[model samples]
Target: AQSVTQPDIHITVSEGASLELRCNYSYGATPYLFWYVQSPGQGLQLLLKYFSGDTLVQGIKGFEAEFKRSQSSFNLRKPSVHWSDAAEYFCAVEPSNTGKLIFGQGTTLQVKP
Candidate 1:
């Protein structure tokens, strides 16, 4: 079974500052990693995903993630974040060949002016 862990429960960053959210996974083999962002009163939006090929993948809303095999981490990053980026971020992992997703506890982002 695969699981996702987001060590940080909450993080605050200034508007227009860089942001990095950590995501670690526990799996015997390489598992699919996904990042999703949920705004207040909104559904989850797929930020990015790591399936194969490239270690670094680009996603929507100026977001990107890098999959590190050695660390079993797939961390999301943004060079510059905006106030609109404030949301709850979730990390998820899909076990081998299973369509089910195991989500992390989620990290909340607070943007400061």
Candidate 2:
């Protein structure tokens, strides 16, 4: 079984400031990690994902994440924060061959002007 954990339930970042969201996972095999963002009253959108190759993966909206196999972590980062970036971000892992997902509780990002 695989599980994802996001320590912070909420995060606040000033506009133009750098932001990072933490995520940890536990799985028996090489897990497919993903980051998704959901704006208020909107559907989830894929930010970035790590399946293989580069440990660092680039995503939309100036977001990127690095996959650390030893640490069992895939942390998302953004160089600059914008007001529109405020949203609920979820860390999920494809746990089974069926591509079933196990998602973390999610972290809500708050951007301040």
lDDT of each: 0.95, 0.94
User: Model 2, 49-99: lDDT tens per residue?
Assistant: 988999999999999999999999999999999999999999999965568
What are the models' TM-scores? 0.97, 0.96
State the lDDT at 46 in candidate 2.
97
RMSD of each: 0.7, 0.9
Q: What is the lDDT of residue 71 in candidate 2?
A: 93
Q: Residue-wise lDDT of candidate 1 within 1-113, one digit each (tens)?
A: 66889999999999989999999999999988899999999999999988999999999999999999999999999999999999999999998869889999999999999
**Where is model 1 more than 4 Å wrong at Cα?**
none
Query: In model 1, what lDDT does residue 26 have?
Result: 96
Clashing pairs in 2: none
Report the C-alpha displacement of residue 25, candidate 2, in angstroms. Answer: 0.4
Among these predicted structures, which one has the highest lDDT? 1
Q: Runs in model 2 with CA error above 4 Å?
A: none
